[model samples]
Target: MRKEKLKVLLVEDDRIEVLKLQRSIAKDLDNYELTLATNGKEAFERIEEDMPNLILLDLNMPDTNGIEFMQIMKGRDELLHIPVIILTTSNNERDIHECYKLGIAGYVIKPLKYEDYEAKIKAIFRYWSLNEFLNY
Candidate 1:
């Protein structure tokens, strides 16, 4: 039996952050097929096309916010099963609570340093990689 490579949908608006994530994931985690979405609208389209194993989503977006996106996703049975990890800069209590309410798999605050950010991303992948619960 062959292990399947994880497909990651990265929904981030910042260009530099996206690049950094790509480089870090490529360097440390080789078994990921990554696709980017610059805004919530784009992310929605991407989700419709291909439901990735994991979604690294940013809360603040142009077309639509993460909260709204999550609401829409949860309503759809077909896309609701896919795990969504909130990777965002907002560390506010309301944001965290709201995200949890919306059933986000995990929430991560974006670090100022690139190395720390990379580590956090790696940790998320590592946890999911070994956990059988998310395999479904």
Candidate 2:
């Protein structure tokens, strides 16, 4: 593994969900350097400031929701290439279709069980880290 941690920006509004992800990363993903943004508006600011290797986004937020954010990213040459994975609870067909249309890297439903959620998190980290997106 690389000594330097991978930058991972997570855009989520739910406080409880945020806490859950944080704990999972702290316990399992030492290779990632996680950053938090409550909404798409804040997400852009963080992206500009640091440039994460990967982004984990939630579909529902207070402002500038995930779809809107993806639309905006498509127009920006600098930000367009950053991979975004949807980590949301929504299973609506439209939401999935729209997200895939906007070119999300992956879509993962947030499992109801904490253990299941943690497993997904681990899998995400393992796959991404193995590819070593940060090396690019």
- Among these predictions, the greatest TM-score belongs to 2
**lDDT tens digits, residue span 27-62, model 2:** 656688899999998999999899998899999998
Candidate achieving the largest lDDT: 2
Once fitted onto the true fold, the runs of candidate 2 whose alpha carbons sit more than 4 angstroms away are none
RMSD per model, one decimal: 1.7, 1.2
Alpha-carbon lDDT, every model: 0.85, 0.89
TM-score of candidate 2 against the unseen true structure: 0.94
Which RMSD does model 1 reach against the true structure? 1.7
lDDT per residue as tens, model 1, 1-136: 1177677899998899899888777865567788899988898899878878889999988888898889888898888778899998899999999989989999999999998998998888777777675566
- Tell me the lDDT of model 1 at 63: 87
Q: Which 10-residue window of candidate 2 scores lowest in summed lDDT? A: 127-136
